[model samples]
Target: MNTTTSPTSTKNLVDTAAANGSFKTFGKAIERAGMSDTLRGAGPFTIFAPTDAAFDKMPAGQLENLFKPENKEELVSLLNYHVVSGRKLVADIGKWEVAKTVNGQSAPIKLADDKVRIDGALVTSADIGSTNGVLHGIDKVNIPTKQ
Candidate 1:
């Protein structure tokens, strides 16, 4: 994997997420999880990035609590829930109904006449390209595992 993980690191998770206005919350979570370097490393990734409005859905102060220094593990798991191995584009998804995430969990892929859903969130934006990965803008964050 390529190892140049800086603020402008190629097309990996970090840079791609940062470029997307919808993924601002996801990007903040990545930084809070201290996963900027790992996600920026060159390995093709498909990230189901949640919008900033999605973060707002959480209970007041809940998001801040999740980002606490002591909650890093949970934050990491949630952020990783968005990533899949390789550069999977919207067209590549086709009729596929499921994709496994980097966190060792599966997110269901739902296709509709006008849109796609990952787990429960609607994919509002699809196929944002990057050098190392692709990103889809999701309306909500998926739970990594069982609650």
Candidate 2:
């Protein structure tokens, strides 16, 4: 079956993920990182959005610290680790250890036993269609690639 999605249809995916309560933190972080506009834009994007559970795993003050004005760059870097340069699906991302991110850094892609993982985050849901790009829900937030 053909699974390509258009930007208009991404809303349904976002809405569905939200309603399921699995992506609340990811949704909020997207807004906080000021990435809603970019992700919602036209083009194919691969979003490795961290789940609410993932956010809960952070240290007591880490999440709050990341949202501070002083830490915007860090937050941006962290979020950028979740995105790639294009709409890369699991089949297209085999065995690559590094992929360029929107933040001008690289993210590690681990493909083992046909199980593809970006950083340590598994591709829980893939091929989420958006007008500009694609959204893939990830289980964890990937750490930024060091400069």
Candidate 3:
């Protein structure tokens, strides 16, 4: 008898986002923030990934300035603001008014009319599963304010 074990599926959050195509700008930001590896790790993270068009919604020169090499720390913090430490699907998030982020701050969540909002960005899609976590596509990039 011959038996073969199928390869274990292991596409993580970063891989999922990169494969989706709509998240190209967000993927680049993840690279600039040096967070590609972290998002690929285990332990279940929930990321609010903004699409390329969302990044374009920023004020003139803002996204460009944030992407500069000198602003890596700021870029990282901003990116982290969109990430929560656990897998929070739409149903799971329905109970939350605020979700703690990896950045050491909390992001306000608003749920109404079957819509979910994180900080001020509307969640355009939700519960994109990965080996390491889940992702929600947002229409705008969320910026964290100093608390």
1 versus 3: better TM-score goes to: 3
For candidate 1, the lDDT comes to 0.76
Q: Taking the tens digit of each residue's C-alpha lDDT, what string does model 3 give over 1-147? A: 111211243678998899878999999999988998889987689899998999999999988888899999999999999899887787778679998999999989898887888888888877877888888889998888962
CA lDDT scores, all candidates in order: 0.76, 0.70, 0.84
Best by TM-score: 3
Model 2 scores worst on lDDT over the 10 consecutive residues at 1-10
Predicted structure 3: lDDT: 0.84
Better candidate by lDDT, 1 or 3: 3
On a 0 to 1 TM-score scale, where does candidate 2 land against the true structure? Answer: 0.81
Runs of candidate 1 with Cα error greater than 4 angstroms are 1-11
Q: Tell how far residue 121 is off in model 2, in angstroms.
A: 1.9
Q: Per-prediction TM-score, please? A: 0.85, 0.81, 0.91
Judge candidate 1 at residue 103 and give its lDDT: 84
Tens-digit per-residue lDDT, 1-147, candidate 2: 223545466353344345546788877776788877676665456777777878888879988888887887788778877777676766777557777887788777888776777877777766666545566767777777472
Candidate 1 vs. true structure, TM-score = 0.85
TM-score-best of 1 and 2:
1
